[model samples]
Target: MHKPQGYPDVSAYLIVPDAAAVLDFCAAAFNADRLRVIARDGGGILHAECRIGDSVVMMGEMPDGPDAHLHLYLADAEAAFDRAVAAGAEIVQPMQSQDDGDLRGGVRDTSGTTWWIARQEEA
Candidate 1:
């Protein structure tokens, strides 16, 4: 089957309580770009798409419970970790340089989604 234009082979669909806030946080913390957003008449988001680097993440407000966590990759793990913290995310793990040569860390967003941010260390 042919894939849609501008979409990756795999993408994450997130259902959170507050789609708008999550979108904003992604933009501020990860430099994500808002691709599209559909809002409900009742003042909540129905669906939205955001681009972080070349990957796109689809998100919407959940009708009931919380959403699942996600893992993200950044060129600079430390900077992304700090930006996420400043944007109201709490640190789940401090940045560490792994033996495999990856810098990684974890943070939980305001809506309770955990993100594992990492990058391959330079040679």
Candidate 2:
């Protein structure tokens, strides 16, 4: 087996109630770039790929399975937190400096997916 271009060895797949809205929110909050989208039979999204920085995330509308949560590392944790709040994401945990020398925060999107965002502090 060979690795695909622009994909990491492992990636996250999200199942949300609204994939399109989630994509839009990610664009506004995390500056994610849409790579591809596949529509479902009736009216929802079947699959979609989005890139946030160098990381790629795949997602789709809710299926017969459990939901997913993700922990993300950002280059600018503060800015990302503000952007996410402004984009209507509910703050699950406020940003704070950790003993490990990192800034961390958490937010829940409209679809109820929680994201833990973090960034290492400058030396």
Candidate 3:
């Protein structure tokens, strides 16, 4: 299915070692609105959905695979970057307003998953 522009047209899962903790951190730091959480016997996240603005980001347990990364376009990437750092996120990329009018940066969560957060400014 194709999602409309400015809405998330794609979804990716971050397979973290600690789904619960990551979920909590995302909620607290980025104001993630958790929509669903499904768990199985081993305390792994079977599935989950979170909304940061118009984007829906999903997550699950890594289940012994390569690390995962997620990208997001926020309303204020610089503010979000600062907040994430204060909330214990590792800085992978410094915040800067792009030439194309996007305030962008990258950070690695405590789970080692990198997220590229950005906010589009009017041209």
- Which lDDT tens digits does candidate 1 get at residues 1-123? 487688898889998888888899999899999988999888989999899999998988875646577877787778989999999999988899879778888898887778889999889
- lDDT, candidate 3, residue 72? 77
- Measure candidate 1: CA RMSD: 2.0
In candidate 1, stretches whose alpha carbon ends up further than 4 angstroms from where it belongs are: 1-4
Q: What is the lDDT of residue 87 in candidate 2?
A: 91
Cα lDDT of candidate 3 equals: 0.77
lDDT of 3 by residue, 1-123 (tens): 465345466766677777777777788668988878899676677877777776777777764546677777776777788888887889888987778778788888888778788888777
Model 3 residue 106 lDDT score:
88
The superposed Cα distance between candidate 3 and the true structure at residue 110, in angstroms, equals 0.9
Local error of candidate 1 at residue 74 (angstroms): 1.3
How many backbone collisions does model 2 have? 0
* Model 2 lDDT tens row, 1-123: 486687887878998888898899899989999989999998899999898888888897874546568888998878999999999999999999889888999999888888888999888
Which residue segments of model 3 deviate by more than 4 Å? 1-9
Better of 2 and 3 by TM-score: 2
